[model samples]
Target: MILINRLRTVLAVTAVIVAPSGGTVLAAPSVPAPVSAAAQPTAPITLRYEANRRSMLAAGIDRPDGDFLLFDPNGRGRVAQVFGDLSTARRIAVLVPGMTNRLANFWRGVGGKSYRSPAVQAADLQRAGAGSGGFAVIAWLGYDTPQGFDEAGRANLARAGAAELERFVAGLVAVRPRATIALLGHSYGSVVIGHAAPRLPPQVTDIAVFGSAGMGVDDVAGLGTGARVWAGQSDQDWVRWVPAARLFGLGHGAKPAGPGFGARVFATADVHDHDHYLSPGTDSLAALARIAGDLP
Candidate 1:
């Protein structure tokens, strides 16, 4: 009876995440074509930042202190805000967030916690790596993220996000050229990175994921990227309870941090939960900063 009850609970959770609303499956949003490497924008980074800021202000996004390289106020919005001087930086990090992230909660976190906000997290990473000099971080929200569990459980949104991420990285490489890049993703954003891994440019040296659902691969070799893979998950994170296997197109594959996944598992001992991995003063943040700065 206990086993049956547990099975039922698992099924219920899966239903909540994968079942169609109103008994009809909605079509996934169309993914835009990737911007080719040669076609990526070649404008000066500062000029692009200023232009984007002006556009954001015109659209009433109200980020007076923000340094945005890209901003589009359409739908849930798309933005890439830099935390340091990109033009002079030798090390660059791009952070991709997870579900329920929209322009509405871009600056302030979804639940109002500074640590959970993409902008704040990027700033924290920037500060942590400040000693390395010439390190910059970009809080990149260039894709339409899944808004709820139903969408998060599926891979469609992640695949779409991967395309956008690929295009953005191409543009970044076109502009920076010499900077070594690191990619960091939290939760479903890890899925996006996983899908983008095979196509990413050689400049990306590391790929780190925390609070991940899954990377849609059984192991690191399956990722098909030369970049070193890192994974972290706090003991208290609720994501540990999520099923680690992909089911009938509903779930992402094995947890990247789990044994045999072949990722360098980092310590998140000071992190409290899913949202706190990037929090200031945590071991997770320090490790992530090291990865971003290309420090061993």
Candidate 2:
């Protein structure tokens, strides 16, 4: 009986929400029963970067590796760190991680460098794109992320994180005005990016989501960003099993890589699992490098 109840809950949350009375939308039953994105307002929003900028900069932490400690709270684990030249870089890539990611686990040293880390992923992207032009990568750990299969696996975290992400992008653009920026969202980070998309800055040229659960919208058009949207998913990824629905805000809206998601499908060949999408020598890494570098 308990197992049956769980299955029923899953089915209920998986169904696309359709609120009658001119509010919610309904969808046809399919793998890609996408809900269209409602129009989002485009307005200039500001960021609060003053609190820690002076303190962090006076410490000279940014000079060594171009590390910009954008935000770090006293008692909290949320942080945003940038790698590479932010002052005059021609391009920048912002990496947003999924669940179980924090400043404490940002990097891991397996042998010499941690390929299993989001920080390393950013560093690898910086290396791949450096030849094309000046570039920087940001491992944005600016939200309170939920762990896998945790009770807090809902959209509230994403919705709040989305606002912070937009603010962070605004701060980045304020520093590097002409740089072409790309957002690389992995796993649940894609959900945050989707919520942030409509309000993203004009300098952002691309938004790429990989191993996403869903992007809180049906298709790329729903994102409401002028930036080109890209999606990639490995066949073996377990996130593919997560039902795509917005009912009760229990899950993200639609699968970005599913049929009719309307994102530019990129190849994820040679990427074995979910954690190593940015691992070196993989097609997924190469494609992300190209996007970050703004290469043809």
Candidate 3:
């Protein structure tokens, strides 16, 4: 009989609790039901072209020059896509890559992680600048680059690419007369910068090399470019172990510090693999940031 009475009491309480708002008996309010599809937070965008385009615009690059402005059928823009605009920037970085590298090569990252390209590199400098407030960067692959690293093929590309590099610099200066540009070369890209350094406009503020085999110099003073020269090579870099003999015989390779090449070598005690020089938290990259005048 007691159990039966308890059950009756529970039902009565539930009925009162769910009673309508205007009922005589006071009752607890009903929980609100979830709304329909029109009300959820949006998922963040992961990979989109807007980030790239925004970075470009923020850097003051509007389009490419001359015949390069036309967008090709491949969705790649003309030469303008390669050489971005250079207006109003206090500091600029021209990141040059080596062998088999095209515009897309700069995006490579470790363990398949997502990373941005040199364009992204430029954006990063802008981001870094936003914090400390004084620099801009550009990813420069605007040359007739070779596709592979066969000895003969590389030598030819070196000579031919140098002329193109010189022209690129000249063209950039024609527009932004006062912008300070820093030439940053990676691997064989270092050779390209070394060759073109002497011929570049006076506006170039520095020449920096990372993971380089050699920079075709006898000493730091020999680098013809008037800018401050800097180098960063990791201890485990294979370039450091490359046989000097291979570069000695009638070749384009020259020791960056042998005699005339003027470069301040940044020690690589904290850098890891060949490509990690620019990675966050590495010592070599930190030195590069200092040379580029960026923050920690």
**Candidate 2: C-alpha lDDT:** 0.72
Model 1 Cα shift for residue 170 (angstroms):
0.7
- Between prediction 1 and prediction 2, the one with superior lDDT is 1
Model 3 lDDT per residue over 1-296, tens place: 88866766665555433332112333234322322111111111111122233333433445322112111112121112223323455566667766555533434422233232444454444444444544655555555455545642245566666776777666557555676777788777787887777788898888888777665555555566678888777767767766433343433454453233446787678876666666666666566766665344
Best-fitting candidate, measured by TM-score?
Answer: 1
Better of 2 and 3 by TM-score: 2
Question: Order the candidates by lDDT, highest first — what do you get?
Answer: 1, 2, 3
For 53-153, candidate 2 gives per-residue lDDT tens digits of 44345443352233434444333355555677666688889999887776556666223347757777888888887765588788888887776555235
Q: Which residue ranges in model 1 land beyond 4 Å of their true spot?
A: 1-41
When summed lDDT is taken over every stretch of 10 residues in candidate 1, the lowest stretch is 31-40
Question: Each model's C-alpha lDDT?
Answer: 0.84, 0.72, 0.53
User: Could you estimate the TM-score for every candidate?
Assistant: 0.85, 0.75, 0.63
Poorly placed runs, candidate 2 (over 4 Å) = 1-66, 71-76, 109-113
Q: lDDT of candidate 1?
A: 0.84
**lDDT of candidate 1 over 164-209, digit per residue (tens):** 8998898889888999899999999999999999999999999999
Task: Give the winner by lDDT.
Answer: 1
